[model samples]
Target: MPVSRRTFLGGGLAAAAVAVTGTPLLAGCASDKKNSAAVNAAVKLPTYQKYGAIKPDLPGNDAVLDAFLKYPANPVKAITDKPGDGQPISFITNIPGAIPPAADNNQFWQAVNERLGSELQISMASNDEYPDKLATRIAGGDLPDIINIPPTTVQIPGLLKAKAMDLTEQLSGDGVLKYPFLANIPTVYWKGCVFNGAIYGVPVPRGMSRTTLPLYRADLLAAKGIKDPAPKNFEEFLALAQEMTAAKENKWAWTKPPLPYIRQMIGLPNQWKEEGGKFTSFYEAEGSSEALEAGRKMVEAGVVNPDTFSAKASARKQWFNGGIASFDIDSFVAWNQYYADNTAGDAFSVNMLDVPGFDGGQGKPWMGSALNNVTAFSKDSKHSVETLLKIANWMAAPFGTEEYLFRKYGLEGRHYTLNGTDPTPTKTGVVETGIGLQYISDSALALYWAGKPDVPQRQHAIQEKIADRLVYDASYGLYSETLSKDGARLTKQMTDLENEIMSGNKPVSDWAPAVKNWLSSGGEKIRGELQQAFTATSGK
Candidate 1:
């Protein structure tokens, strides 16, 4: 339900924290057969066949992404033959931009379909509309061959169990070996796709700690002769924000509430934190109240956009990129996209802020969901399940391969051209590929940028620097019946209350009554169930 440069906005406040973590209720459900993630993981996962087509400039560990300093000069073919069966494959995707030209008139679509050996018809919707549309389509029994299930989907467990193909036998453990590309994906990412103890989909793998970062216009700051862009401590940060504030010039320090970043800076809990086997929600976590108060202070100080709560989501980026605002918070994935879009005459320096602590100590950031989203198949498809599996396999081809090229850039010469191995998209390619193709089934995380060879290294270095200061949710892989059923409503209540406090309409003390209501309204039940799940997984 979140839209930014990409689907995963990463660090949302309380609403996002609870909403993204909720799952479809599967307690004692026939569809899942009572399998837990631990049980599924115990099964033999597919052998991780490393793709050696193009070696990385920076070698990756499980926690890091493969960083490429330059595009492979001689790209190798990963898929030996066309994997798609000569049948039509229908899918639904959440496009972040305008829908591309229809397949009939689009050469890019035609070329991709020709290579896949199937008619890949994509039914597109905006990110905001995807959840409702998916639910409606599933309930109507008009399921597409493939559907992308983001983490934030409502009633995902039930939707997947009732309508999605149970991939336990096909993709569980060694089952995925049948499809070499899918097998190449790391086993850890598959854990996120598991529902009711069975592998249900393939995930777009991402690093655990790479998510939202406090972004600032380093170029703008440098122009003003500010060498040390980031503040040393929380107090200095406030002073710097006020200094950056220029209301009359219509320039401000931020475009949105900075509570999420501030929470990370003060070492606050990420949604849920554990202490002596009990999980504490963000509203009750240590330092959470202070974070809320900090946001209120910024709002009261007139350092951020006054209309931040009411501004359009798209306007946030426009304000930052146009220099109308000098600071904003965005996902780490936006680094390249922001650079590409914002650079015209004066190539600005868009830097990710290393969050500072209250007393100048290194701030701790919360770990992100290990994946962007999952790609699942329908139980009732026009084509055989095997055919769908092969299509997914082809789509999962790693970066620097021919399949990756077709999916990302479309046909060469027409859609894009190689400028010393960096494929520059033509106007046609940009327009046509706007609809999310790579997202349908992307391979493991890669830090490659053809145009900006140094981007991978820069980002990798930053992540490495902050690696130790990352905290994770205690109930990360656990499912709760209460959360599945009442999470949206509960999270929405907290989100509204938090916004009210930030806008100075209410005081931070009001959070206590909200938490009381949340507990009485199933939050207490969620805590107990999640605790049990944690114990089960940890074998404690």
Candidate 2:
């Protein structure tokens, strides 16, 4: 399959293929028999210890995240000792967009190597290419010292057990306390890191910070004499789309079909919904059918851009950012970037749509797994686990620390300059630090927009408002052999069929047989396996 523009994906295929518009469900991956209750019980997770040096402007807790309006003045060092053993560490992570210049040419990379007192080598791949690239590497046994495991990839559990170093002894229970930064990751993110009854990786925690939402340009709407379009139902929502769109003006309600939002408004489950120990894949839900019809109607009405059915994520974002489109459904992570890109003096205030139900009242948001992905140390790694953990701890330093400032800004005067205590990246900084190092390991996710000071406060408030509303993925932290092995293939087939239906190339009736095929092929097995994982983890 070609790299798609789908920004969001639910596990493999849930919340109506939101992956195209937002992000992967951070979706759970494969599992094995080791998913037994006894195994899970014995494998104690890392202890939770929040890392805080500089208090945030809008303080947050476990549910809501801290938001900083400015970079804390004079960041203190998080790690006093060098973390590396001077052994060169090779890492692999997916760069969301452009692959950064290599270490040979990247001054920031060189500086990091200097600071760590070790040669740090990075191999970066685009998100679109990482799956296949990792597959080939895995097949050839040519793995990096630290490898990022994508959520949508299959057989990850088995692979981790076979090739990834088992970190259970090191990270489980109080052991993780040795690396304070790693321990800062919330317990929820680590739960999914367990597979085959062992902990193989450290989760890159994003938590609710990575959810997808329907966003609109409040300023753009205001320009059109529309103060607010807080539609109360699907009817009003559709009407607002039409109201905001004008073909002659090149304005559209959305650049891509807002099917993910529709799916959420229809009250669809994230990926799987469980009741009485029985699981129903979202693919077979009534809400899925409604989302399909609604999406089809949206496409047919011509309220969205002409490229709605096929544009890449970059194009859609350009459309939204340029005000050619007033609305877009994207991951919350995109919020800060969007503000940064809306540089012109033109009015701009990106706002979230209060997504309403199909009839009226509240809409449900399909919250992704707390984890974005996990990074594992390879069995082939020459460095000890403690050393690797130390290395990762250095990388996992929180935003308000000197390590973070240097890692992000680099050779201060050369790569970046301070703008009111915020690290404003120069052109050099942007190019050099673009290697997706964050994918290797990340501190607990937080809200901070350097140049855009007010963004953190506004975004934090928005997060707090919806803290209780998100419908978390029920399949989260569960193991499913079928889901792990066959999820990508089945999800592709399912989403492709959905696209065809929305594009008017296929009939709505086509959904039934396709669903039947999914069920027989692996969906039913996944259902059973998830229930098994759920029961085992619950000690039921």
The best candidate by lDDT is: 2
Candidate 1 lDDT for residue 373: 70
Encode model 2's per-residue lDDT on 237-294: one tens digit a residue.
8898998899898888888778878988988877777676667777888868888988
Tens-digit lDDT track of model 1 for 443-498: 87677666776568777776776666766665555666467557877888898998
The 0-to-1 C-alpha lDDT of every candidate, in the order given, reads 0.72, 0.75
| Candidate 1 lDDT trough over 10 residues, lowest sum | 1-10
